[model samples]
Every structure is written in structure tokens, then in C-alpha cells.
Target: MSTVTGSTTAAISSAVATTTAAAQASVQAAAQSIISGSTNSSMDTSSLVTALVNSKTAGQAATIAAEQTADNTLISAYGTLSAGLSALQAAILPLSDGATLNTFKTTLSGTGVTATAATGAVAGSYSLNVAQVATSQVLTSAGYNASTNLASGSATMTLTVNGQSSTISLNSSNSSIAGIASAINSANDNPGVTATVVTGSDGAHLVLQSNSTGASSGISIAISDSTSTDDLNKLAVTTTAGKSISSASDLTGTDSSGNTINPSQSTISGTGWTQTQAAQDSYFTLGGVGVSSSTNAVNTALSGVTLNLTSAAVGTTQTLTVAQDTSAESSAIDNFVTVYNTLVTTMGSLTTYNASSTSQGVLLGDSTLSVIQNQLAKIVGSGVGSGTTKTTLAAIGITLQADGTLSVDDTTLNAALQNNQSAVTSLFNPTTGIAAQLDDSITNYTSSGGIIQNRTDAINSDLTSLSNQQTTLTAWQAQLTSQYTAQFTALDTLMATMNNNSQYLTQLFGGTNSAGALATNKG
Candidate 1:
């Protein structure tokens, strides 16, 4: 009996423990009641079955739970590390590409003049004097009756400005002065000309203005009258034959009727149109040299520099100084330092160990995190070249700290940008710069299918595996419950039957506390 019991105990120990103490206790109570011959045949066989099943599967269940928890924590830790790396990447992008360091600022000593310098602009000062601003041409026609028809039949009016011309056909429908103005204003192929009608006491006058400002943007109109009676010839203006209305001498010409046209007696000059404003180019001097532009916004005068001119700046000399934008460079470097320090802090927290408290970070001693930290530190501390050409962040006021962070010296940084811009450029060059090196490394560590993601994927796969194990354990538990329920139920009935037989014998042949039925009858 002892051997069989020991073997059974060994088998039970081989399985796991997942059963509640209450279920085991209920089974024990039922067995005790049967042994004591209480005549109670009912037993909590379900509790006994549950207790046995849990015991067989508890170990595997605990193992799966532990592994799942560990995998999930590792995944979360990698997520935090990835976020830190991405932030560091963003902070270094502009610096890595050399955009931040190549910036320049423009300064002008006078008002009404603004300038901007692009990447390739040279750092220097130049004296700029605005002689005149560009002006657009304006031509006003002689007044005529607004409702009177100008074209006797179908005639064409050609409007030309800046060498481009548009011709409109006029008949009885649009022959009036206002109709002609509207037709010119609404023509789809109209050149650089805007037409408007100004109604004065003298009747309606057609005004034509150039859309652009320049010497070449003068306006000219030629009228093709269909017949001799057509009044469309009254709007003809010609700049050919040196007969521009803007000339100092009053232009002289003959009217359509072969009559001598005098400027003093007519509102229109002999050129057939009155000049309100002459088209002219903008004139400015740079370093005592003359420059001209068709527009006030001048970009071609200086390389990588554009000057915005205004009439208020005319007749005055101003100084334009182009220099490296040290402020922006400094700010960018400072931001890099700040974000790098934050990354360092995050990494430190992730890998921290506390001997006194007997505790450590979740990702403590992770090989991937260690490699990333070491590589970043190596790049940040390394110099660019060898020997005399060697340049490091220290040369530009950025230095590595004892706690694995960076610090900046503003005065040194500004002076380096102002005086030794080339050295700064070399230090932050796009291909071999410190920021570029770090950016490349971070991309490898945090980008899609990179180291961090690979690790996270592995952990997720492990979690799935753990989940499968849990499912298998659950199935095994169910099987154990079914088997145990039948065995325990049969054993319970056998025990109850044996207890009842013992009770019947105790009553028939009295033993210990009770006399037998035959002995009581003899007494």
C-alpha cells in the first residue's frame, strides 16, 4: 500500500498545481464523511475534479504568464528607445544637410529698402544708391462724346505695349468711346494694357496704361478706319518717326482731313495722344557702379542677393551688409544639444541599475541599446580630419559633458560663425558631419525593419508563442477535469458503499461501544 501511495504521490507531483485550496478542502470533507459512516452518499465530485485539473496545468500556466509579461515589457522599452532616437534624428536633420550652418542674414542701414541673401551670398558690405524707381506708361485720349459712334463701319483698333499687340474689330455695336474702352479691357489676347474711361466736363476720355514698368513698355495705338468718314482715326498714336508724345518738343502731324494739327489748340499732342506718365526703368548704383532693372525688385545685380527698391529710397545712399546668420546657427546648435541631452537621459533611464535598491531598468544590459549609445558617443566626440585640418565640435563651442550630454559656449560659437565660417561649414558638412553621422546611425536603429523594430517583432512572436502554450495548457486542464470527474465519482461511490457495510456489521455484531443484537436478546 505504501509503495502504491508513494508512486501516486510522485505522479501527482510531476503535474502542475493550479487548484484552489477550497476545492481540495471540499473533497477532503466528503471523503471524511464517507469514512465516518455518516450514511451521506452525496459527494462534491465536481470540486475534486476541478482541484485535480488545476494542479496538472498550473505550472505551464504560470510559465506562460511570466514569459508574456517579460516580452510585453521588452517591447514597450524598445518603443521608448525608438521614440528617443527619432527625436534626436529630427533635431539633427538640418544640421546634417548643412542648411542651418549655411544661412545668411542681410542688414540695411536705411528705410524703404529691404534685402535678402541666399545660401551662396558673399559676406560683405556694399554702398547702394537708388537714383529712380521704374514707372509705367499712361496715355489719355482726347475727350469725345461718350454715346457718339467712332467707327463708320467695321474698323479694327490695334493696341500695342512692350512690343506685344492686340487688335479688336469694331462696328455699330461697339463704336462708342465707352464701348471701345470696354472692348479693349476685356479682349482675351490683350497685351500689357489696361483701359478705362474718365468722364470729365469735356465728355468721356479713354485712358490706356501699361501693365508693366520699363522703358520698353510704352503704349502705341493705330486705328484702321474703314472709310474716310470714320472718326476712329482720332485715336491714332504713333511712336515711330521719333514722334513720341513724351518728347521734349511738341510733336507735329497732319490730321485725317489733311489739316495741320497744333498741340496748343488740341488736347491731344500732334502724336494724337497726351502723355500723362512715361515708361522708365529703375536706376540704382552699387558700389558707385550704375545698374538698371525693368522692375523695382532687383535680383540680377548681385549673386544670391535680391534688393527690393521703393521710391522713398531714391536720391539716398544706404549701406547693405551681408553676413552669416550666426543667431540662427547658434539656435540650431543649441536645439541639437537640447534634444541630444534628452535622448541621453532617456537611454540612461532605460539602462539604469541600482545596486543599493537591488533594482535595474527594464532594458538593462540590452546589447542593441548599448551599441547605439556607444556609436553615437563615438561620432559626437570624434574629429573631422587628421592633424592640422582636424576639426571637432569643440572648435565651434560644443563640447561633450561628463554625463554623456553636450554643452555649448555661445561666445565661441558666434565668433566661429562670424570669423571662421569655413571651419564651421566643414564641421557640419552634409556627407561627413557629426550630425550626419548620427542621423545615419539613428536611421538604421529606428527606421522600418531596423534593429529596434526587429527586436520588437521577435518579442511579439514570442508573445504569440506564449499564447499558444496557454491555449494548450487550457485544453490539457479540460481533459484532466473530465478524466478526474469520472474516477473521483466512482471512488466516492465505492467508499460510501464500504462505509455503509461497516456500519451494518457494527450493528449486527456489536463491537467497542455497542452490544450485538443476539447478545441483547439473550440478556
Candidate 2:
């Protein structure tokens, strides 16, 4: 009996152990199946969620790409058009004004004078005789040792020229003649006076010069000293009754015209310096007529010619000739033709459609661009002036080619300018000519709220909408992913729970065999 009891207990224990092991294996398999997902009864949640979101958002992504591409193309097209228009505008400028059209070339006969001609210069010859060039007033102080301080304490000096006056302050650094010269030069309110320090065999001295050249303008200086016997006063003859430097007068000087300054008791007294050279005006003759000018650059004698007199002699003369500049007019027209042809070619290539090549330009078949091209053609083809003397561009050698660009006949254009300069002037005058019309048209297309700007703005707006939609789709995809993941995770947990319960029941029943039967068999 004891042997049977022990055998029955061992058989039951073995059965229970086998069933428990199988149940655990099943529970693990079920958990793995649920987490991995399957077909039909279960769902491949991750792939489905990604596929659905991608399918819904694909159209929006494609639209964004298309808008971006279109915007890029529009930007490129507008930039190219603007560059061409700018070039055309520059070409139009030289021909628009009457003053620019009446240009003249000037020639000088000799080295004594050089002349420049302006638009108003009438074609004529002029003889120029330079008698005397202009001069500036110069005053020199008596020589002193190089290291001598010209200032005692702080002193103020006044310089007057050309009805203007400036006060100069002397400090320690500017106590010497050199430093004083620097200070005078650096004074902000100084009208037309300059100072310099000159070194001679004897010693250094201060020299003051007026920048104004004529007799009407000269330099005057007065000094007031606060310390000691006034350094500036000591440097000159003392005017005070008993002060003992030279009693003679350096303050008594002559004007630029050699007129003497009358001596008076109030006049400041002398230094050893003398009036070396008097300031004089430049004397010259224009067109055989005697003329005088305060400056060497004589502009008033001739209508538009400014004569820069380089030398002065009593009988020496120069001939100034002003003539029409036909070559300049021809060159300007030629440049216009060249630049216009280039602009037309660029725009043509952009707007044309090619049957042979599959590629199309960014701006091909654009209606606004087509209208602009038409307007340009009309402006180029239209007659320039009102009269019946063949005022159209064809008469001036600027003709439109079949490909819609301009061509220039240099000989014809030059001949036309020579024959009728006024007609040419009227052709491009900004007030009432073809160039004015073209300018107005281009302004409408290029300025603010213009056609090109409006198109660009619309494209930008579309791109912005596409960008916003893409953002919304992206957020929706993330939400879908989270929702799917949570659903699948919960399903997996439920499946695992059911599997665990089945395993527990199978172990309790011992897999279709009773525990008692197994114990009896062992007996």
C-alpha cells in the first residue's frame, strides 16, 4: 500500500508539470501573435495607419511642390524682365533731352588756354589773350629764432578776409609759428585764409595768405594779448606812445591794386616785413575783346565755353572752336540699337514656344508678357516726329527685323543727324516722343501694383496656402499614428489575458486526462 501511494503521487505530479509547461508556451505564443499583428482577424496597425495618412496627404504634398516650382520660375522670369527694362531705360536717357542733343565738341588752338563747350555753345571761333593770371594776398612777419614762442599765456587773434572774420585761440601747443599755422588752418569758421611758416637764412617767420585772388578781397589780422608785453605786439613796431620796438609801420601796407593804406594814429605799427606781391585779377581778352576775371577759370566771357588760362602774355593768343558733335550722336544711337536688339532677343527667347524641343521657358505663353512685347514693338515701329519728313525709325536707320529686334544702318543714321539734328532731338524727347510713350508703358508694368508685381504676389500667396496645408497634414499623420498604436496595444493586452486564462484551464483539467486516473494507472 505504501509503494502504491508513492507511485500515484509521482504520476500525478508529472502530469501536472507537463500541462503547466505547455500552457505557459501557449500564453507566450498568443502574446507574440497579438503584438506583431496579423491578417483578417487582426490588423497590421502600423503599416495601415502610415499608408492611410500618406494616401490622404500625397495630393497636398504634390500641390506644394508644384506651387514652389511655379514661384521659382516666376521669380526668375520677373528678374530677367526687370534687367532688360533697366537696360532699355538707360539707352533711352541720352536721347530724351534737348540740351543733351545740342552737344558740341570744343578744340583749342594753343597751349596757353584750354576750353570746354556746353550744349548752349554756339559754333564760333574765339581768340583768347591772357594778360595776367589772378594773384592772392600774402603777408610775412619778421623772422625769429625757430624755437621762439610767439604766444604769451593765452591770446586771441582775429583773421578777416572777404567780409568774413574768424577768431583763433593760441594755447601752449600752438605757441610757435609752425603750431600757430596749423591752428589757423584747422579753424572751422576761417573764410578764405591760410597760414604757413617759412624758414629763411636768417630765421623762421609766419606767412599769412588770402585764398581769394582779386583786389576786392585781402587778408587782415589783429592780435590782443592778455599776458606780459603781448608777444604779437613785441614782434611788431609798438603803436603805444612810449613802447620801444621800431616806430616805423608794417601795418601801413598797400592793397592788391598798389593803392597805399593811409597812415593813422590808430593803426597798429610795424614789422620789418614788406608787401612783396600785390593780389591781382587775371586779365585776358575773349573774341578780340578785352576782359577781366577774378579767377583763371573764365566762364562768363563765352556762352558755354569755360577758358582755363594757363599762361599770361601781352600778345600771346589762343583760338577756341566749338563745333557740333555728330560722332557722339551717332554713337549714342548705335548703343541704343545694340542694347535694344539684345533686350528683344532675350524677351523673344523667353516667350517663344519651340515645337522641336520639348522644353518650354518659364514665361512661355504668358499673356501679360505677350502684351508687353507687343507694346515694345509698337513703340519701336511708330513714327517719332509729327511732320512729313520721314520721321519714323526706318528713316533714321533703326528698323525692326522680322524677329522683332532693331537694326542700325550707321551711314544713314549719321546722315540723318547731320541733315536734321532737331528732328533727331524730337524723336526721343521725353515730353512727346516714342521714348516717352515707352517709358510710360514700362512704368505701368514695372512699378508698384504693376502687372509683374501682381503676378508675383499671387504666386506667393498660393505657395503660402500650400505650406499651411502641408503642416496640417503632417500633424494629422502624427495623430493617426498615436491612435492606431494605442488601439493595437490594448488589443494585444486583451489577447494575452484570454490566452493566460486558457492555459490555466488546460493545466487544471490536465489536458483531457483526470489526475485520479493517472494515479490509478501508476497503482
Candidate 3:
């Protein structure tokens, strides 16, 4: 408690001890207040710390913003390029297949028949007259009690189909009618025959039918057994008529008037089995020439045409026409043109500059993109064949437009296909075709380790680097905040002590500066 104001200033100055020049200046200003004995003063530490931290980290924030923009643009570019290349690949797949080009289309004028023409079929029209279609052999065994076992001990049955024979064993272990039917159906080598046990109100009857549809493909069954010959022989059947019973049995019948009477009924079973329906070849005529087929699907009667007989009306005639499938060929070329245009448009967007954004595209100046664009333009216009009438894509229907997209002239393409189909096909030859060349070019960019993949990987690496940089910037900002907060708090503490000392000095002495009063009083 000194009456001299200069002594109060000396005490406050001695308390202000700090290494930073700014912190020292703040403490000195507080000392001056004590000499003047003033109390209306404040040190806003919170506001000062906020300002200092912001100023220190502004450069890093700007860097982060720029990096984020670049990362977003690059990611978008990869997606656009990948989708564009995949679409181009799908558009040219049909033209790349040789089988599709050689395929012949067939048409039928009559509802009685359908036709399919194979590869290399000559373009021609022929009249077809179906006399009778092929029929399969059918045989039914005598109705037996379904629960009864028909065979005793062991017996072997031989089944023949289309001149091929397979033997099935019949024994007490599989002697039931159901068991025997299952055994015949499950036979590993059984050819063109299926055995089934059909149940009716009378009983269960074993029905054996030929899987094929001709006399040469009929089924023949024979039993080799010494015992139970009567039961085993019942399963045997022959296509040669009259070898077994084909006679009528008297059955109870009901008339439309509801009167019960005796009616003659034909039975297909006896001591042995006989054919109910004989296997016969299909009879038809091609261009008034007689022909025969063992099956309804007639393949060999014509050179490359296969006729399937649906219904046989002896007097009816149908027309079968085989011709080049020009529509299919044209459609394939059209698809290729469409996909090419899509790819070109996407690439243009990715490489174009946007004045609104004041920025160029992410891939604007990429050398790889330039290479892809130049190569694609060259491929569509170049000639693709040597010994062909149509040499280039432009010679046909597909031609490049001013905007780097492909356009098709359908009339021109169809004429080329109609005139020399081989030459048109050669233009898309698997070895050196327009479609092949385009496919090759697209694969270079879309396949593994391609240019697009490499570029994507580089962008990903850059994103990783950016993430690391953001982390480092965040840590640097945190450190700066801690440093600023500590310095301002220290300065505020010095100023508050100085203010308290000044108030005490003014109460003991006066509110105004008293340095001159102290010197005169000392004199």
C-alpha cells in the first residue's frame, strides 16, 4: 500500500513475465493503467484466440477445398468412361459371330407344317404335300390284379428298339407289375421304349409303347424263361400281326336309351401280346416328288431344310420358303451404330470445357483419352477387307458423322446385303471385319490393365493422399488452437491483476495520474 502511483506501476511491471513479445506488450499496457489509476479496461481473450487460429489455418483450408473438387471430378470421369466402353462392346457381339451370318430364315404359308432351315441352305421355295405322318407302335398287356405278382422265380425279357436290343431281368425281387414297369423304365441301356402301369376301374394294366415313331424304330419284346412261361409270355409283343390274339370279346354295354345289352369289344391281350398300332414311316411329297421319313421332323429328305409335320391332310399342300435373313443382319448393324454414338457423346462431355464452372473436364487434356478418340475415328472409316466388293464401313450403310458418332443408312445397307451377301458378311469378318476392329479397339480400354483401369487406379491413389493430407491439416489446426488459447489466457491473467492493483492505488491516492505529485512530494 504505497501512496506513490509510480511504486504501483513498478509492482505491476515486475509481475508481467512472459517469453512472447505480444504477451509482454499486453502486460505492459496493464502496468500503464495502474500509474494512471484507471479501472474501465478489458482483455477479450476468446475473440483474439479465434482470430489468430483462423488466420493460421486459412491456407490449408483452401488446399482441402481444391483437392475435394478434383477428387469428385476424377471419380465421375471413371464411371462415365467405364459405362461407355461396356455399351460399345455389347453392340458388336452379334456381328462378331460367324454362325449368325450363315443362318438361313424359313417361313411357312400353311398352318399344317413348320420348317427350319439350317446353315448353308439354298434360297428356294417348294410345295409340300403330307400323305400320312409317322406313327409309333403301341401295345397293352392283359389287365392283371395290380397287387398280384405275375412272374415266379427269375425270367429275362428282351426289348428291341430301332434294331438295338437291351435285356431286362424279371425276378421275384421285382416281380410285381409295378416293380416290373419301374425296372423297364430304369434300365440303363433301354432304347426308345417306356413301360407304364395304367390303372383303371377294371384293374391295373401294363402298357408298353415305342418312344420312336417309325416301323424301323418299333419295339419288340421276347421272354426267355423255363418256368412261369405262361405269366412271363404275357408281356411279350410282336409287330407282325396274327402271331397273337386280335379278336372281340362280349362285354356288357349300355345303349343311349339306358338299356343294358351285349356289345362286341376288341381285346389287345391274350396268352401273348399283339400290336394295337403298327409303326409306320411318314409319307409326303416335295415338289411332287415322293419321299419318306422315319420321324415327323423331316431332316434328310431335303438338302438343308428340316420340315416338321404337324397334321396330315392327304389332299392339302403347303409352301416352304428359305431365304437370306436380311432383316436380322440389318438390325445387328443398327445396334452397333447406336452404341457407337452413345460412347462418342459421353466422351465428348467428359473432355469438354464448362464455362459456367470456369473449369475444364477432369479428362480434358488426358493423353490416353486422346489416343482412344483418334483410334476410334480411324477404325470406322478404314477399309476392313481384301477380296471383297464392299471394302469399308462407308461402302455399306454405317458412316461416321461430323460429331464423331456413327449413322446408318438402312436402304444402302439392305441393298448391299441383298446384292452380294458374302461381301457384306466379309466386312464383319471375325479376322478383319469392321465389327472385329471396333471390338478390338474397345477391349484395349475396357479390359483388365487397360487405359481406363490405370487412370482409375491413379485417381484412387490421389484420393488416399488427399485423405492423409486432411488428417495432417486437422492435427495442425488443433495444435494452433492450443497454442493461441494458452497465450491469450496468460495475457488475460496479467491484465486482470494489473487492473486490480490500479483500483487499489486509486482508492489510496487519486483517480488521475500522480507521477508529478510523487516527485514534488519527495522534494
Per-residue alpha-carbon lDDT of candidate 2 for residues 294-348, written as tens digits (9 for 90 to 100): 6778888888778787653445777778888888878777877888888888887
- The count of residue-pair clashes in candidate 1 stands at 2
- Candidate RMSDs in order: 8.8, 17.8, 14.0
lDDT of each: 0.77, 0.67, 0.70
- Best-matching candidate per TM-score: 1
**Residue 359 miss distance in model 2 (angstroms):** 2.8
Per-residue error (Å), model 3, residue 175: 5.2
Regions of candidate 1 where Cα sits further than 4 Å from its true position: 1-51, 141-158, 163-187, 195-207, 222-273, 356-359, 477-523
How does residue 326 of candidate 3 score in lDDT? 79
Better of 1 and 3 by TM-score: 1
The sequence of per-residue lDDT tens digits that candidate 1 reaches over residues 3-122 is 111212323333323333444555566555444434555666775576556555656565566556666767877889998899989999889998888788999999879998886787
2 against 3, candidate with superior lDDT? 3
Order of candidate numbers by TM-score, starting with the best: 1, 3, 2
Candidate 1 local lDDT, residue 514: 92
Q: Can you give the lDDT of residue 399 in candidate 1?
A: 94
Clashing pairs in 2: 250-270
Q: Candidate 3 lDDT, tens digit per residue, 122-199?
A: 788888777666778777776777877777777888887767888988876676778878888898998878888888
Question: Alpha-carbon error at 173 in model 3, in Å?
Answer: 10
Steric overlap count per candidate: 2, 1, 0
